[model samples]
Target: AQSVTQLDSHVSVSEGTPVLLRCNYSSSYSPSLFWYVQHPNKGLQLLLKYTSAATLVKGINGFEAEFKKSETSFHLTKPSAHMSDAAEYFCVVSDPGGGYNKLIFGAGTRLAVHP
Candidate 1:
């Protein structure tokens, strides 16, 4: 069984500061990882993903994550945070089996931006 844990339920950032969200996972085999963001009442959008190609993956909105197999961690980071960056972020892990993907979603991290 694989699972993901979000270290913090909420994160607050200043308008122009950097943003960091922590995530940890436990999996029997190497799994695919992803980060998705959702605004107030909008749908979820893919921030980035790692599918066994590159250890470092970049996504939209200047966000990126590095796959650290040894640490079993995939943390999301942004060089600078913007007002629009304020949203709920989810860390997800998927296992590819028999030509199918089983996804496990994280609880979610709520990001608050202060002006």
Candidate 2:
């Protein structure tokens, strides 16, 4: 079975500061990791993903994640935080047999940006 855990339930950052949301995953095989963000009144949006191609994967909105197989972690980071970046972020791992249909999501981290 594959699962993901988000280290923080809430993260607060001042505008222009660095942002980090930690995540750890457990999998038996090479795992597919993803980060999704959902705003107050919107659907989940794909932030980034890792599928054994590159350790460092970049996504939209100046966000990126590093796939650390050794640590079983794929933490999301941003050089600077923006007001629009505040949202509920979920760390997800896909089922090896189920493909895109089956996904395991973490508890989620709520990001709060302050000016």
Candidate 3:
């Protein structure tokens, strides 16, 4: 089984400022970790993923995250925040043992971008 914990329920930032979203997970087996973004009623979009191939993974826009095995952490970061970056973020955990289609998502982090 795999699970995720989103440290914050909300993150606020101003335009052109740095943004950070923290996440952690646990699993019986090595799991595939992912970060997805949802804007309003739109469908979820894949931000980035860690598949044991690389430690640091870069996603769309300026978003990036690092998978730390020892800490079981995958925290997302962006050097500068944009107004359009405001959205709900989810940290997902998936295990091949569960067919890879099953994903356990975190509660979510709402990002509010100020002008």
Best by TM-score: 2
C-alpha displacement of 12 in model 1, angstroms? 0.3
Candidate 1 lDDT over 22-80, as tens digits, reads: 99988877789999999999999999999889999999999999899999999999988
Q: Is candidate 2 or candidate 3 better by lDDT?
A: 2
Tens digit per residue, CA lDDT, model 3, 38-75: 99999999999888888999999989999998998999
User: In order, what is each prediction's RMSD in angstroms?
Assistant: 1.2, 1.3, 1.2
lDDT of 2 by residue, 1-115 (tens): 8999999999999999999999999998799999999999999999999988999999999999999999999999999999999899999998876545478999999999999
Candidate 2 structure lDDT: 0.95
TM-score for all models, in order of appearance: 0.94, 0.96, 0.94
| Alpha-carbon runs more than 4 Å astray in model 2 | 98-101
| Residue 14 Cα positional deviation in candidate 2, in Å, after optimal superposition | 0.1
| Cα RMSD of predicted structure 1 | 1.2
- For each predicted model, how many residue pairs clash, with residues at least 3 apart or on different chains? 0, 0, 0
